[model samples]
Target chain A: MRLTYVFIAATMLLVHLSASGQSQEIPSVPLKALTGKHFDTVQFNERENPVILSFWATWCGPCLKELDAINDVYADWQEETGVELYAISTDDSRGIKRVKPLVNGKGWEFEVLLDENQDFQRKMNVVAMPTVLVVYKGKIIYQHTSYVPGSENKLYEKILEYSK
Target chain B: MVKKTGLLFLGLTLISNLSNAQISGSLESTGQRYVDDNKIQLDGEDAEHRYRSNSYLKLDYITGSWSFGVQGESYLPLSLLNYNPELKGVDIGTVYARYSNKKLGLDVTAGHFYEQFGSGLILRSWEDRQLGINNAILGGRVEYAPADALTFTFLGGRQRVGLGFDLSKGTLYGANIEAGLSDILAISTVDISFGLSYVGRYEDYEHRYLNGNNAHLVNSYSGRLSVSKGGFYSEIEYVHKGKDLLMNMGAPLIDGNKKAGNAFLLDLGYARKGLGVNASLRRMENMRFYSQHDLDGNVFNRGVVNYVPALTKQYDYALQNIYVYQAQPQYQTTPKIAAGEIGGQLDLYYKFKKNSALGGKYGTQVALNTSYWGGLDIEGDPETGMYTTKALGFGDKYYNDMAVEVRKKWSKNWSSVFMYLNQHYNRGYIEGKGGMVNATTATAETTYKFGKSQSIRMEGQHQWVKDNFKNWAAATVEYGLDQHWSFYVHDSYNYGLDKIHYYNLGASFSKNSSRVALSYGRQRGGLLCVGGVCRMVTEAAGFTLYVSTSF
Candidate 1:
């Protein structure tokens, strides 16, 4: 039974590889700001520099750690690479109320958006938390999942490489 | 099966010829190999089958205004411990086709899809693999937004019950409208928004109960209002559920055992650059809505139709999670007759400026949170299922938590965090066993960075309790070799009572959009909760492998 699934999965991968070339465009989903306003995700494409999307939640430990690590050096990264980071909170109603205070309390400078129903996360094929993706020219250039302690440094490297 | 595969292949081949099409997917697999140990051992089916694995493969394609996706799940040999038994073997979990036009502000979907209306008080259809919950609706939905400030959604479907496209007997219908009044009024000072939702569950239970008084359809309606001005924001929501027959242990009872449910929730907050304060209060009375009427209050959380998570601070760390709180939104007639729950929580976050007294070299971050919950004060009889609840009152205390945390960066390479928590848990009412427990926990953690990209973090924690698992001590050490590799070891010991040590050591490798982790550990026997929903698992020891990748 397992072998059957493996064969199907391998077949699907082959199809995917055959059809892949151009960088995938960001889905035009509605992103809700903390101040209760909705905007189209395609707006990120208008920026000249690269844009980073970090999917996170309040209950996720590694997500917070990754966000905190990036928050510490966010100003420097922006100054050097002219990149903007958007920390998208995938917290449902269970922890939606905490997003505002937690973001403000930690004094993070990145723009924060709410994916209250996880529509944006699902549309992006993000299965796990702390998934970071760097977008250049409205196309996803680089992406990574599950952050370690020093993963932010690697992400910054990607940002710098793409910003040029 | 062969025909279906061929059709899917044909469809993909036809679509892949398009020059502008895109393909994306994600895969996740978790396998466990149980081994017998002297201190801890697996039991029942888990022990009999030494190897168990669960895997999911999802593929999605997009071109122009059309999109299609399918998810396949496999639980070969067996699923993980505590997963729903109905999910067995390899099968197509969900499939959907959608047509979305941004210019027309219209979206339509057919087949399995997930949706939530306003806080999910009235309706929520989603999938949580860890909880073995995939209640996506299997039907049609249409969403249209006439303007930027207003949107409307209508959906009707049967809830997915299990794998192999097993659907519920009942049908679910929902309609929602959300509007931003500020946008229409052109008011720039404050933002005002409101939403209204309606959800109905139609299940034919007339033949079984023989009670003509009970209706075949159960309806729920919710209204919400939000207004935020400057740094202050507030929101209020209310829901009223139509009367329906109450079930006792998965069986419908006659003799006017029907009851109406309602819920009220409020949130108020003020936030600025370096400080934020928020408070929430909620009251629910018999608000459990199930797609199938008889499946109410099921242990596996199957057939649940709404989302009512416990509005409490979700803490991180091992010791802090032992005394977790689960929302009480169902009628209980076991030890005592109870309606639902009423409670509130408060949170405050503040950051100290750099070079200040509280802030050393880097800024200091402080967070304080507290919450209290109790049963509703109801005057009723369990025989007839009729009750009168006080408009505002606390019947019996259920849970209380108070916690404070402080984080400080000593230098460029060192940072530390300290936390303390106090909890008062009424185990008898919440868990149906054990007495009231009063416990306090304290933890301290520090991280140091060295070399180019190497870092080490150590955490120490201890919990003290007078009753119900007396004392516990836990410690963890994690080392990050570079950007892609990390290793950690954790040990949690219950010294006072069971004297059992739950130890786990693991290493993880992560690259772009992929991660793999391997661990060996003694599993803890308790309620494993995610997003406030919990499942029970027996004590066992095993080697676990997890692999996930996404394109």
Candidate 2:
């Protein structure tokens, strides 16, 4: 019976691999919004505008620093480039409680998503925390990992590049 | 025949849906070939399974508001050295079906799920592969929001203890309700919310010493209230537990009542413009509650019914992580005394002007953090299993840390970060090794961007201590080309411990959501931690490889 299950799993993997030849976008997964709504990654926008997804966790000190830096200039960036920033929290059940309180406390201005299982983070092949990636028109335009204090400015530059 | 047909039918249906649906998943496989190491034991006879591999394949099918996912894991022959051999095998790890409707304000998940309530002080169900812990409940969960201001969540199921389905069964169930008063009151000046949660765990079997009469059903309750207005915010949570007999009362021969346990947590923050300050405080006594009756906290963190972790800073630097504080989950059951802990942490962050004297070119960021925790002043008689404390009075200090960090960018292409940390760790009380050790660590990291798609980063760190591995130094350099290739070399030298050098060289390549890494390294055998949870990391000399891909 276990062998049967393995065969079925392998078959599914092969089938899915064949279908994965197309252009890459953000990983298609359902994550909860801070407002208790589930959002599909593929249906992000009505148009192919640039979308910046920054994967972070509450326990990650660098991630919070980067997010806080971006939060300071977030409004200006959004106004200029019309780029939507998704601060994706990869914190699981243990740290999920801190997310809401911290978000509200910090008064962040980005759309917050919960990847409690890290399904989206795993699909995106994020190797480390504080990974910021820009996706536009079904293609990954830019990605940067391991944020230093001033690394957020580089992310803004990439966002502007993709917005254009 | 019927089972095979059913599986085939399911596979075909999923495969057919893959043609049009947006299906994404990931596969991660980590393989290691171990060699004998002098520091960590590996050769006598138990090391027959010299090759260890841990692999996970996850598939998520998301169609609009509905999502179905499955995870399969394989630990061939043996799991990691830290992981129990009983968990070695290939099996379907988890499978779940979930549906969410924005219009109805409802979300539901069935089969297997993870959940938490209010900082996880009372309840938390999660999975951490590196820690070899996956306490995801095999059950059903529902979240409902009748209005935008109110939300309710409920879950009930047995926890997955080991690889198989029918092993050492235990049940965990919880429900939480939260309501935002400002939204319901139609006011914007003040934002207030309150939540209440109840969690219960039951297992038929109990430790022989603890006696089968140990409360078959244990309950924990939590209440939280949060208030935020303008730049000021504060949140508090209080948890109370019913009588739990599974707890060790100074070697299990206690005669009297082990009535209840309690914890109180408070978090306050104020952030406005470029300045932010936050503080957290917690007091807990006899709060190490588990689902089953196994002592010493179950290996791999399984059967943990509640989560209470260290409130100290989780440092990212290597040396800063050496003296990390772990929450005292279990009461100190020594012949001398028995007590819990009371502790807190404070953080202050400020940024200077971009062109100011202190800020230089890109601006300066200064962060100061301090945290400390100590055992409570309580005395317990083994015969009675009772203790008294001086009402929030702190006893001997268990651990404390002070840190300051400064970050500045010199130019568009160059950036630097410097950090210093001083820590005092009571190993006797915390880790049960050296008596007490004081350490100071300093680290400097620099990053230079060469071109639009090329960058190099390097870091140097050193720690000085008077005892226990007196001094340590680590250095790492990494070069990366935007999204395709990254190579890194790192070495950490322990000057005191036989002058061993833990070294590694690795490179990773990623394109369009798939990545593979190869490395040869020597790992230091010690306690590796994840979110305040600690597990043994065996010293190893090996060649390692990792592959992760998403489809």
Model 2, runs deviating above 4 Å: A1-43, A46-48, A58-80, A91-164, B1-14, B17-20, B37-41, B63-65, B166-168, B206-212, B249-257
Determine the backbone clash count of candidate 2: 0
Interface RMSD score of candidate 2: 5.9
Candidate 1: residue A104 lDDT (0-100)? 91
Please provide, for model 2 over B376-463, each residue's C-alpha lDDT reduced to its tens digit, 9 standing for 90 to 100: 8887765565677776788888899999988777776777889999999988887666788899999999878776568788999999
Tens digits of per-residue lDDT for model 1, A15-51: 5653464367888898799989988898888889999
lDDT of 2: 0.74
Runs off by more than 4 Å, candidate 1: A1-22, B2-14, B17-19, B206-209, B254-256
Model 1 chain B: worst 10 consecutive residues (lDDT sum): B1-10
B497 Cα displacement, candidate 2 (Å): 3.8
The CAPRI classification for model 1 reads as: medium
TM-score of chain B of each: 0.97, 0.94
Per-residue alpha-carbon lDDT of model 2 for A48-104, expressed as tens digits?
A: 678888899977866876786687688899889988888999976435545665665
Query: Which ten residues in a row are the worst by lDDT in model 2 chain A?
Result: A20-29
Chain A TM-scores of all predicted models: 0.91, 0.82
DockQ of 1: 0.59
